[model samples]
Target: MSKTNQVKEDTKSVFQNKGSRRNFLKYSGAGIATAGILLMGCEDNENMVPDLDGVVNLGSGDVGVLNYAYVLEQLEAAFYINVVTNLYRNISDVERTMMEDLRNHEVAHRDFLKAALGSNAIGELTFDFSSVNFNNRESVLATAKVFEDLGVAAYNGAGKLLQNPDFLLIAGKIVSVEARHAAAIRSILDSDPKSFAGNDVIDANGLDRAFEPAMVLNAASTFILNKINASQLPTS
Candidate 1:
């Protein structure tokens, strides 16, 4: 066979063998196998502002990861604050109380990161949530669910990327709280209160989903005024 043909076949086999490879690891030792989960070839879809115009570069190393989390928290905090400060038309007292709690929780998370990172923390980000219809309950709840779920996945994915065990431990704690927020938002979204752990985020094996930095940021960038470059974040 020609060299080009052999190369094409090799590449195809590699992808095709991924499932078998994953199965082998699973059979070897489930716990150890899961620790090796790393996404390959994830594209950078963040609509980055031209560097010529000056963009926010989330510095390299552990600091970049923290800045990424901080920026996400900033977005969440701003969103919940917006919802709480301006109650929608005919929004119930129950919703008002819940939103107030969410707002406070997000604010606490954002502030904690800021304090932890000190001067390394990313600056406050401005958001463009014009697509959200605050007056409509359905619209508000749906958006909340989206953000919370994304937050959980973002934390989970970034957890493995942290070199510092302290940072990883703290990220795990934050993700747990984010998962709770996701569940609460999901419950409110569906008329049935028991729909918190929907299939969208939780799989058949009851595992939470994870997205690489680029994937998460791309999904989230639509809401923020500033774009984040997470390329410098550690992958291993």
Candidate 2:
């Protein structure tokens, strides 16, 4: 099967598997296969990301950055999937549609990066969203805000680390989308809507917040069950 079609099928299976829902969120979460589970058979593959004592290392250069982005996309996609599937209490039609759209966008981002990375793509990641109370609308929205804002910051920070122009361009485009997602979620949660240029994420220089890979991973590792090693990623 073509790479795109293969990704579609893989994602379809994930979405259709109701039994796996328990793996994602504390309440109705859908779990994706962990790298530890998927990497057992690829021990000899030279192109695969190195697995040292179950730690999935994000290889150096643009590939590492792409894989890092892929991880965030996976987390965002899974969160939105569970949110749409279970629909928090007393959700409005507008909110439901917004969640669905966000899910689609995140899934697309996940698939695109997977396809672009091809054989170099890292294995699917497992997440522990036990902290998010999916049954409550307030809890769900607040968590969404965190993910969107973090995703935007992650992309912004990683963009500078990419050595290839094409990869940098792709990162720029994805970050813009993430910024929009952040704005949308913020608008839903806040009484006053400031859009993508919100003050919380923007500094006095009027630029969105940027987080280095280590910092981003440190913040994100709480929700991620897998051990990710970004030690090899470029710094300058």
Q: Which candidate is the best by TM-score?
A: 2
Cα lDDT tens digits, model 2, 1-236, are: 86545544443344332553233222112223322123222222343456888798877767778889989999999999989988999999999988987887788678766656656778899999899998898899999999999999999889889876656766776787778788888888878756546777899898889999899999999999999988878897
Best by lDDT: 2
Query: Which runs in model 2 stand beyond 4 Å of their true positions?
Result: 1-49
Tell me how many residue pairs clash in candidate 2. Answer: 2
Q: What is the C-alpha RMSD of each candidate to the true structure, in Å?
A: 15.1, 8.5
- Enumerate residue pairs that collide in model 1: none
TM-score of 2: 0.79
What's the true lDDT of residue 79 in model 2?
94
lDDT of 1 by residue, 17-65 (tens): 3564344222222222222121111212242222434467776666678
For candidate 1, what is the lDDT?
0.72
